[model samples]
Target chain A: MTSTNHTLFEDYLRGYISDEEKKRLELVLDSSETEREEFDLYKTMRRTLSPNIGNPYKERELKEHLEELGKKYTHEFSNEVMEMPVVRKAGYVRRILSVAASFTLVGLIGIAAMIPKNTSKALAQAYVYSSDSTAPSRSVNGDNLITSSEEYYLSGMQAFKEHKYETAIISTRKAKVGASPELIQEIEWLMALSELGLGNDAKAKELLTEISTDTKSDFSGEAKELLEDLNGIMHRISSFF
Target chain B: MPTAKTYLNGIKQTSHKVQHPDQKYIEALRTNDMILVEDIYKNYGQMITDLVKKNNGNAQDAMDLFQEVLIILHRYSQEGFTLTCSLKSFLYTLCKRRWINELKKKGRAETLKVADISDLNFAEESKESVEGTEMYDQRFRFCKEKFNLLSPGCKEIIQLSWRKQEDGKYCSWKEIAEELDMSYAYIRKKASQCKARLIELARKDPGFKNL
Candidate 1:
């Protein structure tokens, strides 16, 4: 009911309380249902939010790794679907649908061209890539021999700045191997930006989705903003059809 | 009735010990073993994609669902959870249940086309595991959401209070006090007050009962 009681509860939970204080606190908790319930909730919160010391970055690392796996497997699945057999009798029907689809695709493209170009692309272009706060800084002209990770990361950022998105993507992907958690987060952000600059919306969206979902990532806010823009464009396009 | 301490301790116990053959997958998730995790995706990824797509979802939705389910798996594995069924069955069951829940939330439940889960041999165990994990995940998420609603000062002190140092030991109040430029007594009291506020917020939520 009071801050003092909560402090006592905390002391007791952390085993910092003396025997007398612990007994008093237990008595108070036992006598009052409201206090007991509060203790339960507080205890649960402490347990739930306790940091994973063994691998503090497990979720972030796993998410990034799984994003790559998802991309690969999804691509394979799509190819498998394409290679699947179709009935010979439906060839004419398929041809007719193909013709209609072609016209629809052209019509959609024309409409897309007439509208203001996708705002997502504009937003992605305008997104300023900030360096990760946790990542260690290295001078480009440092006398020390650069490690592979550093080399790739530096080149990736260089390519990104030069507007060579394909090169940026390639360099960052190489940089991701054996990188620190901070560097991995930065590399993924860079890769997402490269994908966006190259107008590869699906890959950009996939990369952004992974980054945005991580609340602790440095680029999460920017990723979320870009994702919202991308989703808005997608919704508008889908609704038009 | 058991006291809160006993109840909390019970949850912390290694409740299940009969490890299934699929326990390796849980370990892979917990340890962030990228190669094993990729193997998990290679083996079960298509199955999940098919499950989601069959239920009116797209590739992106399927990907999102897969990542989410993996997160749940990771959490349970961290808590010393033992697999009583095959990982595939457990994952498939969780995904299937979660997809349905998503559809229900979106008011598109009627459009859900159920996948054939008849071949999943450990149906009851899988269902029970899914339910338990869902409840645990929901409760944690609810409390975390409430924790985020506290004042900035409250959140910071509470976070820094139990934060681990390089040696993997929790920071003492004195250390936290120095870090925050406050007295030890003040830091401890602030963290306690903040924690109390967080718990109170959770208790006051309309969905507290559900959690």
Candidate 2:
């Protein structure tokens, strides 16, 4: 270990060394063991003293940056956001879905706040999407999958929840277009289940078979199980016939 | 101009690499040489985001990875290191290192056998950045905390001067003077003074010193 080096020495080591001084320091480093050790200690101390400055854009900075970037992409953003299947945008889905999904999550602080929370209808609508009957209009000419059609799917989800088996079929079928292949299978499963619930085993079997083939994971596995139940229902129906 | 041309050439030559660097829109990133590193965030950003997301991380992980790899590349440059592999590969290796260290720190270290080697190999001629990226990352965080404590004016002047390099030679004293609208000597002197104050601040903070 060497004796203390001053702040000037620290600065020089902190990339503040001049060309002449750099040469001189190099000579000094070569000249003696004590000088080398001193320089080494100084280097270590400067590095130890040097605070690692992070990159300029921190998380909040990036968030602001993203907002700025988002503005530039506004046309792209609005077009995509409007096309989002979830209906709600990134920052505000919860409030809209709260009243929309059902009145179940709506606490006792209810219709006194506004329209009364319809508990029975909301509960019955729990398993299914309620039907709005409006199919999102698709414009294939412009590569637009009719956006107007989602109303049916949303309604079907609500209708299934309310145990409206017949209405659930109509709403879900109407909402079925423009969804990805996976959701198509899911909608098929829902439709089949509702039909079986309404005692239409033959129609249920055909729809359930369609869902079983979409096989891509847990959801498909459940569809397969339901299909087996539908087959069992078919055997009983045939026996009665 | 020669150095800029050389870097541009370096970018062009890297096209055939195992990992292609993305550089179609370089001007978006505020960089002295966006030409060299443009492909970096574009090619590897999502892969990192996906990796982190898979491991219970989030967009914050992507930010950390992006910044740390940059600091690592900058430090290597300050040490006169050369690039061997395409920038894409080097960035991939550096980001993976940062992510691995972060996971270990989180106390749920699951070192998956991620199959990615194209980015880890550097040209044999370029100096190894085999060390101190982790250290610099910590140091940078410390410096940033201290930076928050500095006078706004000091922070501004320091950042402006720090970004003055164009072809990696401080652009020009005259240009900087014009930009700052001050005499050349004044710009140089004020920059030094601001840097000195930054050092003093760093020196005093125990956390900064640890980094």
Output the number of the lDDT-best candidate: 1
**Candidate 2 runs further than 4 Å off:** A1-241, B1-38, B41-50, B57-90, B101-130, B156-197, B206-211
lDDT of 1 by residue, A48-114 (tens): 6665322347677877888887777764542232211122445888899989999999998888777
Candidate 1 lDDT at B129 equals 67
Candidate 2 chain A minimal-lDDT segment of 10 residues: A77-86
Clashes of each: 0, 37
Q: What is candidate 2's lDDT per residue for A167-206, written digit by digit as tens? A: 6666666667776554565567667666655444445566
Per-candidate TM-score, chain A: 0.44, 0.35
Assess the local accuracy of residue A15 in candidate 2 as a C-alpha lDDT between 0 and 100: 49
Best by DockQ: 1
Write the residue-wise lDDT of candidate 2 on B24-75 in tens digits. 2221233334433434444555555555444434344455566555544454
Instruction: Report the CAPRI category for model 2.
Output: incorrect
